[model samples]
Target: MKAFLLVGFGGLAGSMCRYATSLLFTRAQSDFAWGTWIANVLGCLLIGLIYGLSEKFQWLTPEWRLFLTTGFCGGYTTFSAFAFENLKLLESGNYWTFSIYSVTSFAIGLLAVAAGVFLTKM
Candidate 1:
């Protein structure tokens, strides 16, 4: 029960943050779903940091890990939105945008995670 509450609260906070990001990006008037991309990539980076810290310093308890990774990061990242956006781009004949967005998101997301982990080593 305690763990559940922690995860629930973390998810709530993460979801709120993600929504705020979307609102901020919406103001930019760009067709790209920058908010979702940023959120997912940032979430990946954050999870990497959290895991690295956990491994290096034993800082986070299991409960904290669950809250941060499974709850917060899970809520913060938007895989469904990413997939849907890609579908929209494909359907709309924006192959160039779709290809770039899809490739960059994956590549950069992996790099962000690696960077976060590397930062912890230093």
Candidate 2:
């Protein structure tokens, strides 16, 4: 319950940050979603930095880790979680699994979105 609360609070803040970013970086044209793209990239970078710092130093407590990584990053951009997981797989030398996971995740994720849209329309 406490962990959940921490995550929820962090998520709330992260969501607000994402919204603010979207407002600040409004795209002049619809060809690209700069706001979302920047959010994901920044989220990934932040999570990576936190992970690295935690690994190098034992400063961050479990609650802080949960709040920052799970709550904030999850809310900010789930792609960061995916990116971090992929990075871990690569670091651990699981090349084949990493390759498979990367390819299938993107390909099937796109397909899933298409399927969802089609199903919703029909």
**Estimated TM-score per prediction?**
0.60, 0.94
Q: What is the C-alpha RMSD of each candidate to the true structure, in Å?
A: 16.0, 1.1
Give the poorly placed runs of model 1, Cα more than 4 Å off. Answer: 78-122
Q: What is the C-alpha lDDT of each candidate?
A: 0.81, 0.94
> On residues 1-122, what C-alpha lDDT tens digit does candidate 2 reach at each position?
99999999989989999999888887887778989999999999999999999989988999999999999988898899999999999999999999999999999999999999999998
Give Cα distance to truth, residue 31, candidate 2, Å: 0.8
Q: So what's the TM-score on candidate 1?
A: 0.60
lDDT of 1 by residue, 1-122 (tens): 99899889888988998898777765466788888778777777777787778989999999998898777877787563466468679989999999999999999999999999999999
Task: Name the regions of candidate 2 deviating beyond 4 angstroms.
Answer: none
